[model samples]
Target: MILLFGLFFILLIIGTSIANSMFISSIIYMIYYGLPLEMIPQRMAAGVDSFTLLAVIFFVLAGALMNRGGITTRIFTLAEKCVGHYTGGLAHANVLASIIFAGMSGSAIADTGGLGAIELKAMKDGGYDEDFSLAITGASSLIGPVIPPSVPLVLFGVTASQSVGDLFNAGIIPGILLGIIMMVVNYFICRKRNYGVSPKASLKEVLKCFIWAFWAIFLVVIIRGGIAFGVFTPTEAAVIAVAYAIILGLIYKAVKIKELPSVIKETLGTSVSVLYILSAATLFSWILTYEQIPQTIAGYLIGLTDNALLLLLIIMLILLFVGLFMDITPAIVILTPILLPAVSAVGIDLIWFGVIMILCLLVGLITPPVGMVLFVLSGISDVPIAKISRAIAPYLVASIGVILLIIFYVYLMTLNPSLPKLY
Candidate 1:
């Protein structure tokens, strides 16, 4: 196993794509261990065979379609009209837009790539500091993976063998709390910097923006409401979301029919990238399970401390560190099997743990040295990664605080049977 991981990192250091690196390392491991070489293909195939994975594909498609369908502009307009009057109002609008966009697009890369461009432009044009604009854009993009229709949550559910709907439920409160906390942090920063604020929207203008954005807002309500009411599964919700996006595009005449092929092509590219990584990670995980890696790690951790809270904090630290170096999808796929057993041994609910794990990993997405969202924003805004990383420090602190709050909340809920059920 050490040899396999060594080769994997060596491949990564040499600039191999994550999917290829995992596949190649797994192949070498099988050859060394004299396992059936054919099992590699079998495991990879099995990785994407789940019915749950279908949701990921559809959601990726939905997000891509919505991005080109003119939803983001309306979302941004509505966010600005609603919150642009506050200090650092555009920053507040950035966070709010992310919260709204999060419901439509579950992928962080999508949020940063699609909306980051627009938000960064708005903030920069509004005379906000470039570093601050880029930093907040990247930070807010983390919300994409925390809210409902989240791709990471779906992957976590399948990888951990938990209910996707339940995981979605667990994310709702944490997602909103994280956004609110970031907004608070933005409020203070804006006040300190004396950032410019927009004129307050009139009742008429507010109503107009709201009416224009009503369909986009309804997307979230319908998806969440449908799942909560058992109107459809998450996978079905993705299909519904796609249909809804298409209908909106047609009705608004914003997304041209000629644009769909490219939209679909982009979606296919993204879905293929994710699915391939999943397939590779699935094979890698099989190797870990076959060697009882998760059990050994779980036993060692359990031996260190029997206190669930302490153990969870320790795990969060480790995941946070890992997130700094790895992308969230492969991290979730590879770590879920290893960490799930450890956390379950301490009597933590997998549903709540899923939210914690994902949120922590996502914070890494905004962290330095391979933070994907940071790179995305930097590319879009022409800002240096170093400056963006520095600017993101406070938001990172706020995000970590949100994670700690979730840990405590989940722990308290475990102890208090009177608390309302999250799902």
Candidate 2:
């Protein structure tokens, strides 16, 4: 097991995709264990044959559809109305719009790419620092997971066998906390730099734009609420979201029939990559379990520290380091199962762990070398990573603060004293 683990890391470091890396690693392990090659295809196929995982594809499609629908403008317009009077108004607007849309998209890259252009251009026109604008936008996009319909949390629940609805609800307070942290920090920066502040609009003006976006955001509320209340399953909610987004798009003329091909094509492209990685990771995890790898590692860690919080903190640091080079989706898919039982063995709540896992993965979207959100924002704002990295210092601090909160406090808020009997 140790030898196989070492080889996996080597393949990963050599710039292999997680799927290819996992496939190779699995093959190596089978040979090492004297297993037949025939099981490889079978295990990989079975790993991906999950009904819950269908939510992954649906969420991706919903995000693409929402992006194409006229909802993007309504969201931005609503954000502009609410925050355009603040110093660094456009920057705030971008972040605000992302929080709203994150509930819909569940992807930081989608938030940055879809909503970033307007914010970047507005901040530049308003004379804010380019690096500052991009860095803030990039960091703010992390709110996606914490907000709602979080892809990472969905993937985490499926991988770890936690309740998806509980994980979604558990994210609400922490997500709001993250957004508030960003807003306060951003406010300080704006005042310090003397950034532009738009003139205050009338109540009527604010309400007008919000009314325009009311239907758009209402869709998010209905989908999330319906799922939580058991009015619909996650799969059913996704179908509704797609239909709603399409209707709004056609009504507002934001999307047309000719554009359906492009939207579906993009959705299919991304879904395939994500699902394939999931399948590969599943087979890889099966091998790890077969060798009792997590059990062995967990035993050593328990010996090192019986204190649950300490173990969780240590694991978090390792995850932070992992985030530097790996993307969130694959990282969570790979690590959640390995670490979950260890944490739960110490009485950690699965829902809270899901939050921590998602938060840790969210950081990967902004960290170096593989910071997907950072790169997207930089391209839109035309800022260098070095400068963006420099500007992101405060947000890095904020994200860490959110992580620690979940580690120590969110468990109390999200978990019941006794889990309800499943039988």
| Candidate maximizing TM-score | 1
TM-score of each: 0.98, 0.94
Give the local distance difference test score of model 2. Answer: 0.80
Q: Give the alpha carbon lDDT tens digit for every residue of 252-337 in model 2.
A: 89899899889989989998898888878878888878878788778887888877778888888989998998888778877887
Residue-pair clashes per candidate: 0, 0
Off by over 4 Å in 1: none
Q: Give the total clashing residue pairs for model 1.
A: 0
Shift in Å, residue 357, candidate 2: 1.0
The residue pairs that clash in candidate 1, if any, are none
| Highest lDDT model number | 1
Model 2, residue pairs in steric clash: none
* Per-residue lDDT over 160-230 for candidate 1, one digit per residue giving the tens place of the 0 to 100 score: 98999999988888888989999999999999999889999999999999998999889999999999999
How does candidate 1 fare on TM-score?
0.98
Q: Each candidate's lDDT (Cα)?
A: 0.90, 0.80
